[model samples]
Target: MIEIKNLSKIYKDEFLYRNFNCAFEENKVNVILGSSGSGKTTLFRMMLGLEKYEAGQILGFNHKKIAVVFQEDRLVEWMNVYDNVAFVLKSSVEKQEMDKLINKALELVELIDYVNYSVKDLSGGMQRRVVLARAIVCRDSILFMDEPFKGLDDELRLRIITRLKVHWRENRTTVFLITHSQQEGMLLGDIIYKLAEKPVKFYKI
Candidate 1:
């Protein structure tokens, strides 16, 4: 479990979260919800140690393996589909096994046909899927995803979300997904956290 108490991050005139507090259960899907600039992603950054909070307590599985998909695809344009996934996998993967998982991940994201294709050649949605598949295939215990489905169509979103839910369930991995939509947040969240500027509130949605 991860516990955060009285956490705060401030820069100049901006305050990400003041006296923020929460606990994240292990092996569960936790959704962080808010409109733009509501400090949801800011809080995520704090949790990931990307930004330092002024004052608070944050405790979780220390040195736990983490994987992320930022709002941007973050894919290497020059790399082929398989190589991107292979990058994070080297820590615990053999060449042949990595190849197998890359294929499995691409297929899961409906991009198996593009396995040999360069990321530069893929469309936005297709690249998003590849990014997602890369993160998911990391087989990490904790995942942080920021707006991974932003530009996806309804059909693609549902399909990818369904596959993600299934994969997470099978592995019992802990997940933190940040999104602006209530619908998207509620779809796969076991717990929902809402962020606001003045007073942050969290509840089961």
Candidate 2:
């Protein structure tokens, strides 16, 4: 389990979090639901150790491999779909194993047909799937996603959500996703946390 105790952060003159406390259960899809500028991204960054908190303790975060899907695609525009996913594993796996994993991830995202296409050439939704494939290929113990389904239409979003559910069922990785969509929470979250007005109240759904 991941625990946050007395978490606090300040942005400019505003208090984002003040003595906030929450816990994320292991091996489940945990959703953080909040509006823009409510500090949902900040909380995710703090948990991932990508940002610092003024005063807080984040337990169960050390020595664990973490994979993240940021709001932006963040793909290498020069690289093709296959190479983009392969890039993350190049340092850790042999060429044969890397190809196998890349193939499997692409298949999972239904992007196998476009394997050789450059990331810059794909549509927004396709690029989003490539990002998902990249994160899934990592097979890390923890996954963090921020508005992962941002630009997709409803049908595509639902399809991707179904695929993600299957992936979670198979891998049982601890997932922490933040989004403002209640429908997404209903579809993907095993445990949902709603971040209300500041001093930041967290309520379970």
Provide the TM-score for each candidate, comma-separated.
0.94, 0.95
lDDT of 1 by residue, 40-123 (tens): 787788888898778988898598989888988888899998888788998898888888888878878888988889999988
Candidate 1 error regions (>4 Å):
11-14
* Candidate 2 residue pairs that clash: none
Q: Give the TM-score of candidate 1.
A: 0.94
Model 2 segments more than 4 A misplaced: none
Q: Which candidate is the best by TM-score?
A: 2
Judging by lDDT against the true structure, name the best candidate: 2
Q: Look at candidate 1 and tell me the lDDT of residue 2.
A: 91
> Measured by TM-score, how close is model 2 to the native structure?
0.95
For all candidates in order, the CA lDDT equals: 0.84, 0.90
Cα displacement (Å) at residue 182, model 1: 1.4
Quote the positional error of residue 84 for candidate 1 in Å.
1.1
RMSD (Cα, Å) for all candidates, in order, is 1.5, 1.3
The 10 consecutive residues of candidate 1 with the worst lDDT sum are 196-205
